[model samples]
Target: MADKGPVAMIDPSQLMRPEPTFNDKPLQAYRDYTIDDTDPIKERVRRTYYEMHSKMTVDLFKEKREKWLKFNHFKATVKDALIRLNEVVDESDPDLDLPNIVHAFQTAERIRHDHPDDDWFHLTGLIHDLGKVMALYGEPQWCVVGDTFALGCKWADAIVYGPESFKNNPDTYNPKYKQVSICTKKKNFVTTTLYGMYKPHCGLDNLLISWSHDEYLYQFLKHNKSTIPEEGLVMIRYHSFYPWHSGGEYRHLTNEKDVETLKHVTEFNKYDLYTKSEKIPDIEALWPYYEKLIEKYIPGVCEW
Candidate 1:
């Protein structure tokens, strides 16, 4: 990853305006899950999480880690792996219905447009969702996509679908787990504020996040000893951990390192989530730049 210091002079005027919130785009129907009952896309998203929440137990996560952490499932270059991921559509996304590759390119391009000097940041956006290839490899969407939360602990009320989504989850019946601290549904409590004001230091490593593509790619990068910096890796790993990054859950599990990582993850989340719109990237034109990026940071065929 590039240094935190500015790599090149950035013209504040040229930076693209922040992506509009869903509430700001009232004219066009965008991913408004509040109306999931009437919106088929949102309904599908809900159903996807229904399965994810119900089945993703600590034991299941451990079982999956045992299988995938070996990094022996397959081997392919970064581009090849991403193209393979193109076949997998995220069932949990209420936004666009494009190929995953398109989403990957969109994210990277948006980051490039905004932060041109930091090629590492651009690469982070490009490869962030490459782990979704698990879905193409026969993993169900329930296990591969959606918001991830910690297992072996109390479920947070602020998670997207709320505790109702975990009704059938085996972990819900466990009595040993209890809520440590929860950021209330306060209006001004954003991700950073949630971490600063309501932050807890229970230790990130001790917490068990729900098995998803985020964890898979994170472990893959670590096992192979890829050079992507810790912040970049955190962006890859926790971009979908909305319950922590967006919902303010699991603040109790974060240590000081997580507090610092949270800033980068929060910044990366804007490009990751808000870039999915009608505009698609010219993959042929963009490929050369990102291909070179892959070579620089995560080159050659890597274990999957």
Candidate 2:
């Protein structure tokens, strides 16, 4: 893990809240990825996605998994890791510009409100993005935040910015990762079209998804032996996978398990996305409740 500079603390009381339906903005108003060079924030979001699409390749995904999965980076309790998010501002997000910690509490509180009986679900929402802590160390935000896609396959048409953003990526041209198909005529003439390396209906777990905080924290929880339920874990792992869950792509690569996983991820997505701009939760007042959750499911200092 790399050294981190001082992170300024945010006072929940000082934060401004959004007003109405899905944080005052219309439901469709969120996730506006319109390309406008004149708009600084839009440009930042575009640049971040283009860079992520161009740089996150199958090989790089493998390398990142090997590196971070080692769990040798650093140690912190779940609460401490959540606090580290105070320094993270997701460049890929066009919505909410607040620190990631604010979003974490926002998501968790929303989940708790709706699913009062599911403490695990509340905790899952709180810690889903804890993997973004990699940003505080040495990882770049491009790979740490944003929607993730499978690398060893055809880029889903629904992926943010579509396939056009991946034109500069070497893996886009790599035959092994490119999706292809072939047809044969009576004379033995063959027509070929690119498909990817994975077989049809190979479970989502079998595919190599682009590296992001979602996958990192999913693996992290497993490594630390956290008792978050399978549904909660699936929610954490694939919530950022908007292409499959939200865009309705990749059915060819998913199996029965993914069918169930989709339900959980979709249920969890409401709190994650819609709650981002809601009134900031009183973090200081709320910590005790979540601390109890952390202690119950994932107590003590954990390996990063």
Tens digits of per-residue lDDT, candidate 2, 74-114, equal 99899988998999998989887889999999889888988
Candidate 1 per-residue lDDT, tens place, 1-304, comes to 8645312211121132234542234323333454335567667887898888889887899999898888788888988998886688788887778889898988898889889999999999999998888887778999998778777777776566677778898767654443233334665443222222222576766677889999999988887778888889989988877767766667666888888888888899878877787677899898899989999898888988
What is the Å distance of residue 137 in model 2 from its true position?
1.1
What is candidate 2's TM-score against the reference?
Answer: 0.89
lDDT for position 27 in model 1: 24
State residue 299's C-alpha deviation in candidate 2, in Å: 0.2
Worst 10 residues of 2 by lDDT: 9-18
True-structure lDDT of candidate 1: 0.76
TM-score of every prediction relative to native: 0.83, 0.89
Model 1 TM-score, all chains together:
0.83
lDDT of each: 0.76, 0.83
